[model samples]
Target: MTWITEFAPTTEGLNACIDCGLCLPTCPTYRLTGDESASPRGRIAAMRAVDRGLMPVDDRFAGVMDLCLQCLACETACPSLVPFGKLMEGARAEIAAHRPDTATIGKRVLFGRLVGFRPALVFLSWLLAIAQRLRLTDVLPSSAAKAAALRPVPIPVPSTAGHEWLPEGEQVGTVAFLSGCVMDQWYSDVHVAVIEVLRTAGYRVVAPPNQTCCGAMAAHEGAAYDAARMAERNVAAFAGHDLVFVDSAGCSAHMKDYDQWTEGGSDLAVRVVDATEFIAGLIAKGALPAAVETTEPIAIQDPCHLRHAQGIIEEPRAILRAAGLEPVEIDPTGMCCGAAGAYQLSHPDISDELGRMKASQIVATGLPRVASANPGCEMQLKTFLDDGVEVVHPVEVYWKAINTRPVRQAWRALKTVPRRN
Candidate 1:
């Protein structure tokens, strides 16, 4: 009945918690439920007990662990620099090793077989888009309807795979792009924006068709095997490129920790950078043109992965400022919007409550447009926020600002190299 594996939490991470109570205020579940079992400290305590054989790894323990948003806000607040995110993933992997229920089985299939396969994911997205257009989701059960509603209007995925975009005049450097699973299928426009912005910054962008999912969702759900396989594939796909740019916050954070998943991953992990972070660096170098005009204020909703996990809080804001947009902070506490990957679909009730809370904070800012780096957060905000509110990636906003300038457009037209396979 023991479920301990190499993926289970380590004693070092468990013992690192000093019971400081600092993480209590940062945990969304604890703040919402006011339960000790919901907070990071409490969860660590349970993990310790399970590690020591004092507590059984039963359904109750799994429930407690699953309740967490795994947003890693607590890790940001922890002075000890505890690897809580890693520990949590390990614990979940252990639980998944022992628990093989209907839900877990479904997740395995979804993350392993479907999300890992780009074509299958694209086809599924097409089906979802059609279903949404036909209003067929309304007829599904409540849970299924909620899942279906998460999909944004699907756009044609640009032909970027196996192709490269060369910057005009002089290429600064070459960087690989991760056209992620859901990102490529549902939010392909963001990829286009990222590539355009990067190209504008004088970097050659390459989309390797061999790259697959970053395995963030699988790792989050305890499918470590699938995640490791993905890490290996990505490491090989993006090999020889010194820098790899990822547009999705979740994928960026996960890829940054690829070393933890597979050997040779550290080589890829060290090179992975968030697209916004890369753009911010380019702005600092004055490689990109200055903004000709300023836009209206936008509410900046920090995705948990970007703000907390990667410690990339100011880069996106700097990019917005460089693009001549006023960036408004929605929540200083860095609370989760409840869209923790597929967390919204699995825990819709808690997800909705947190989504409403985040949406309210954004609405209070009174900004018509919101910049969120992650697709999940953007979708969650779109679902809960008013119809007048707009959610877009920061790079998308930057692309718009630069693309609208006449001189820049002229320069782009002359300098932009055609896509080459």
Candidate 2:
């Protein structure tokens, strides 16, 4: 079989790479392997080879493509402004169409079928939480154990569908929130904080019930048809809202490109805003109060989706500062933590190497806590970082800073913390 006629990547994006090698240092896979085939240019070269009918879309070709984290840092570094992310996604789509392997089939099942249903996802999360609590994951196979270990412990209850929170004071218009599938089930606390923070800033927040997964995981896995269907569903769900706020960086990034996936999605795409960006704007406008009391320093680990994909570098820091926290820069280069959606599960070895690199950088800063926006990054950091090191969403830290009483904070500080493992 050859490249899927309809799903093949556009030659324009494939030919945009000029072999400048600027993307090499920024690519996680290339940096780890020092292999030209792993570099962005090398991958594009392979894509071109296949596009020209010089190579076959076989296991070897799929292996090279699968190795990428899809972090899109190379896009930021490329002088030619190559759309590496889109091109890579297209290549993967072609592979998925022509290959149809067991793993590909499983990815389609999980991302396409399972993620869209909140009840099933929550039920599975509950079971996984129980398994983690019981330490049953340790007894599972190596790969299964690793996947289970990433599940959030003490999983918060899923956010209510179609829930709406009114502003604390004067009304300042309404906005919709994306309670993502995995995020709503596992990290619902962050959504609570997001709502509280938004309300505190005088914006009514609503979690649209009709919204489903942002389809980022599906898109990254080459399930374009499923991804497009999910995008179309979200476009219809979020229509009429002037602004749709998303707390998950990965979701925010994907939603911003809805036009690429489906018709009528561009309107929704333009309305999507990263929560940090919106909150930062509020802070700049003095919509929220200044810090009541200063907190400890936090190292900011920028998710690749947030940093490279969305080009939101300083907004998170702005939010952190308004909460009276000093945000430390672990790496200005914005190296990926290797949690590019499901990349950690698919490429655990490379993911671990990158996670360890990020953890070491954070540890070197000697900060007690790390502030990360994306759920995947937070989990990856928690897995590799020292058990004592607290990993939290920046908004969670901000919420605690403004809401927690001094006595309660002191009491909480004195309580013994349990080991995550």
Candidate 3:
């Protein structure tokens, strides 16, 4: 095998890299280290070297590759369509294949077991909640924490773990709502709001049975085999739906690239839609509920996956604008919030710097509420230390506010619909 094939590289994957370096200004690690090795192109070159046997998959290779936040910023900036996200994921898979057991017992906490099971997620949520209730966070020493920003945002066990689904009257189409691995524990309400917003737009929303984490986590961690199994499960489970609505941008973005995950590819690729895109689609069709009257400013942070992976730039803003709120854009140009999966835990220093910068931008907007699509962003942004700034999902932004009567009224209609759909 040649350079391209050594690390399980594909001709298509390598061909995708045009080396324009549009990703340079946007890469957080590159911005920090000012090293080519930290840039996406530099890392790609290293992967190529490892593939070609010009370089060993030694500590140096791992050191350079591991520096990436893998924020997908490059994907948005790339003119070559490099699929840098998958490239990094593949590189990690290469690393993990040759790497040692790095997962701590707590960190590993039944990841395989929780992959497909909701009960495990619920249990973890309760555990996190218990840790919170016991003030265990305060007891955690400095050694246990890297910085205030890198600290884990434990998932709360909500008063209602999840609300019972009620579709509003007649449905427009069928959709399967994916309960993600972490979101089920942290921002499950955003998903609940997704269902509410969808039903409001006249869709029959269903949480697909036995759905698991979209294998994005495993794929990025180099477990493509496990990732494929998760994707296959979702493909089969959501087979007959008119659409599959994934609330988390990260999961939706990865699933959209299902072709890359499977050697044989999946047919369910086209039906998957991100929540923002779907809601925006409803707005386009004039099925969107009336916008709410708001007297507040909403600071918006674009998730890299939503913006770059899916080419989704406007739907979320359309939802916010139609809802009568001012959408204040965070003007970092092309920065990621550094919550690219578990990057915060893996590289705390860089993650903290990015998170603080992002939070400061949100705070400068002087908005009491901040909204984004991905749950990882939600958890990461929840640590924003500004006085009185509450971060929320855009769906939650509308559903929780009383001023959005049409939106809420749409939810009212959902309560009256038949549930067995």
Candidate 4:
């Protein structure tokens, strides 16, 4: 303990680990490798050593950190309640500042630019979607292939199509939506479903005229300057909204943490809210619009961020039940579907393995279909889904349940879907 004097992690709050190793079993990377070095505890140690100047941040160190899913399961498991998420972000930031290499350079380029701008991000997604449909991925190398496979078939952003604003029926509240980078292009259906549900619930939803990416990609990858700038821009863009809702867990986590990201900087930290937080608060207040019945038994996978990061374990399920679904629990404590950010692509073997296990767990529940609140879990579950299994976001299912009159059309949407169960 004496060795720790000056250069602790800039992410702050790393001393909470206490070397308890309580988080190892819960971490997917730790479970797969059976190496403590891959666990949160070991990573913290490496981070500590690097901070103390006893070790240089080298290729091996980056590899260890890279292997992490950043799922935040470890944070939930800790009794001392360390902020491992921030620590990891800081560790990455430190790495990014000093070790700009060929390996991470492309990511810094792609994700940095994607979250930093809206027009190019949307256009790139459209191209990727076209490429997917055209089978154009065949020409790509292994690295690019990995990126494409993890991505959903991209779709058109509704905003550029035109300002499809929600009805103005004496707004009960105002909400700004985070049409995230990948979520915008690949999982447009989920975003659309969220909007539909919000509008139906009687609130005027606004896609903030000046809003941009939520900066999650850059933040996680350690592009601090770029991520901070994105945050600052969002803080300015989202000035007057009553609440900000982000459906993607990755984005939700980042948005909620904007207060932390700009602890001493931005003044808009108080405005950020995860989509579920807003939706749940709406439901609790009885401001939400009433919906129809969905008697179908629905299985739910709580994304680690939705569950562990924001303490939003019950809102998605509550909305499901309130909307008339059976609300079956796939895992009461919730488990990762193994799609931790870029995990499914980076470590396909382990990602697939964890996803298969989760898929099996969902299937075993004997539920007709599964629902998750986050787009990543939905996509991950869909990738290995066997026959008789269907995946959806919670908002999609909830919206479909409104009214015994039976809506003329299904409310939910997805890209590259095979067929409905």
Candidate 5:
């Protein structure tokens, strides 16, 4: 029977699944639950059933879709190259459109509207900062509370103005940097580190003032229309630049597929590169110095988006090695830390379980520091791990080791420089 639903999972995508169950072993949920339904293969079967009208897009279907972390671990594991992530997102889009309960509507508004909207996001950051200072975050839901605990001090709106970093020597090229929604307000220091790394590579970095979020959170949750709108806005924001560098793994992964969301998205999507990839490229070209004797052993926690979605397995390690630091590889294949873009809030038990497991693995290495690419993964590592263990973006570690002065001092010195238009 032909599928009549407007946003039905693509038949070709569903057909690509060979059902070999290769994804079963890699799936975090399946590993946790030992249930087929939690596996990617099982989820694909459910999508097929819905497409054939054999199953309704009811609460069960919603549960199946929502329970997924969308880490794309299955996509990496699938030998058939089945676009399981896209199919699951398609099914979720249908569910979101047809079923509009109060909870669903509230989440749709929150993720779709407020989260990516810069002004709203900044305002919420301020509110969260206040909540955190007052110790009122305990009243918040689990995931939010955890996020608040990990959040760096909020930078006010005035300080949110964009900056352009001019390369000191002969410029390699010009690129636009995406200072992401929550990232800018909460983790501003990381953005600073990203700019410093770019500067060190001799690349002029322009951070457009009016940029919005990359909309990965929206797309993952099936808010297709909002995600598309966000993609269009970002494409327009960084239109003139040849390269657009994103430091956030989730944001970079989502922006790389911006073409799928909007009409002119390819213009931006094609230019998008992950910060680690860009820095690694610089190191390979000898544009940046190598290996500055870090005495401590560092552990690299591969963010799922970087490792699975973007296929960036080696660049970070290469960067670590270049910085004169030894990277400890975690066991069990660097599985998801359950910070899959708010998955911790939605499925606290599984999220916490995965997080604890990851923390255990990191601790086993006996490393004082853990390096990760994504802000969420870093936050999760920080929240779940031992207090003595410090979690940071890999670039931050590299930046600290490479720069002569302290990172904070270098960041402050950079901030004093005016944006070079």
Candidate 6:
């Protein structure tokens, strides 16, 4: 229960921060509040204070850590290469163990217990959908109202049956697809789009059965052990595949670090690739079909995980451009849409501020359709943007343009894939 064994591993990362104040301009919270405690340097200072026994792991210490979006923008700007994201995760884990408040318990129950269970999220989405249909979402609490407002339309969970879709003559590679928890439930349309785009690119797809959540939500909420458990399951589930593709930016970014969780994690991590990154590679090699042209300007809202976490800033844009859609960039620094997986519920005020800021940036581009890679980001963007403006995944856009091939009856197994909820 002591601090050393609990939080010592992150001490090196904390000590590595140079406190140069270079990250201030990049930090969303620091920019909003102008408080040192909210910036990366300030949070690291608090971690160092607790590690040195100069400060206790009290509510005040937890407050500073909770305020962080974990966007990792500071890490991108840091000259010292400090592992701020990992350090913040470790600090949050310690806070979760030492300080269990109502909000903490709520997050643990929602993220730890419910998020990974596919059945629960499916049912919750169903109920939310019903609530929206009945015009009852407004009666919900503020946080629930925000989430409810995001997803006006809910899609049923898609079956994750093993699919081996091959091109008519050529087979580029056999890749496994990750049907993430929420991704499969709420945004199954995007999954369908991903499959079509991959198939069109000559890649044979293999979606493993019995896949679980990628644990990004749990990990971000300070449940590292639980996240590790999910990682081990995924590592074993996705074994033997030459490459594993994920459309969800957060899931891809988190899974790419599976090596830190258990044995053979790095093996799985290396094989993991974002769908945009993979399709963009196909475009680069001229293996995919001709670009499907469009004249409408498409505003690109880069997901923080895609841009900052994985350094995949251009692949989504590249894919959009190759599809003949005009790609408009907003916030080159990859500002977070504040949808850090249940962060809106945990930190409603800050989440709203960041979400509004992101929506405004997209609106300023004067585009009606905005392309993003993450479902959470899409939801966040939709929540704050005008009702007519569509927030869709870049893959969805790419799928629309190049998907001229008819659905082969054999590949239509997913159409009737059984639903549990």
Give the Cα lDDT of each candidate. Answer: 0.85, 0.85, 0.70, 0.71, 0.82, 0.79
Report lDDT (Cα) of residue 346, candidate 1. 72
Per-residue lDDT of model 1, residues 1-421, tens digit only: 2546777888888999999999999999998899999999999999999888888888989999999999999999999888999999998888888888888878878886689987787688778878778888768885465545454555553335678889755787899989888787677788888888887778888889898999999999888888889999999999999999999999999999999998899999999999878888887776676564556688999999999999998988887887789889888888999989778777889998999999999999988888999988987888788779888788888888778768587756655657579
TM-score of each: 0.93, 0.92, 0.86, 0.85, 0.92, 0.90
Clashes of 4: 5
lDDT of 6 by residue, 1-421 (tens): 2473342436677778878999899999999999999888889988888888899889898888888898889888989999887787778777777777787777777777787777787788788777778888768776776655555545453456455566434566788989787677677788888887777666788878766788888778877677777888888889888899998999999999887776889999999998889888877876664355656688988888888889998898888887679888888878788888777866888899999999998889888888988888887887788888888788787777765544333324333456589
lDDT of 5 by residue, 1-421 (tens): 3334444689789999988998898999999999899889889998888878798888998898889999898999889999877787788788888787876677778888998766787777787777777878757676766855466565454233377889865687787889888777788778888788877667888888878888888888777788888888888888888899888999999999887888899888889999999999888876676675655678889998999999998999888887778888985465899988868767989988998999999999988888888888988888788779888787887887778656435645554567788
Model 6 misplaced regions, further than 4 Å: 1-9, 138-141, 150-156, 161-169, 292-294, 405-421
Q: Give the winner by TM-score.
A: 1
**Per-structure clash totals for the candidates:** 0, 0, 3, 5, 1, 1
Give residue 386's lDDT in candidate 5 (0 to 100). Answer: 71
Q: Give candidate 3 misplaced runs (Cα > 4 Å).
A: 1-7, 103-113, 141-166, 263-265, 292-295, 401-421
Residue 319, candidate 1: C-alpha displacement in angstroms: 1.6
lDDT of 2 by residue, 1-421 (tens): 2577465777888878889999899888998999999999989999999988999998889999999999999999999989888988889898888888899999988988789878889888888888878888768874355545364545565655688899866688899989898888778788888898888777888888998999998999998899999999999888889999999999999999998999899889999999999988987876665574556678899999999999999999988887899899999999999877778678889988998999999999998888999988988888788778888888887787767677335423433344377
Error of 4 at 158 (Å): 3.0
> What lDDT score is found at residue 27 in candidate 5?
91
Q: Candidate 1 at 300: error in angstroms?
A: 0.9
- Which of the two, 5 or 6, has more TM-score? 5
Candidate 4, residues 121-229: lDDT per residue as tens digits?
Answer: 6677677778777878756874355344444563444442224456434455667777666676677777777777677566667776666677777877777667777
Candidate 3, after superposition: displacement of residue 331 in Å? 1.8
Please estimate how well model 3 matches the true structure, expressed as its whole-model Cα lDDT. Answer: 0.70
Residue 394 displacement (Å), model 1: 0.7
Candidate 3 clashing pairs?
A: 93-222, 168-414, 172-202
* Model 2 collision count: 0
The 10 consecutive residues of candidate 1 with the worst lDDT sum are: 151-160
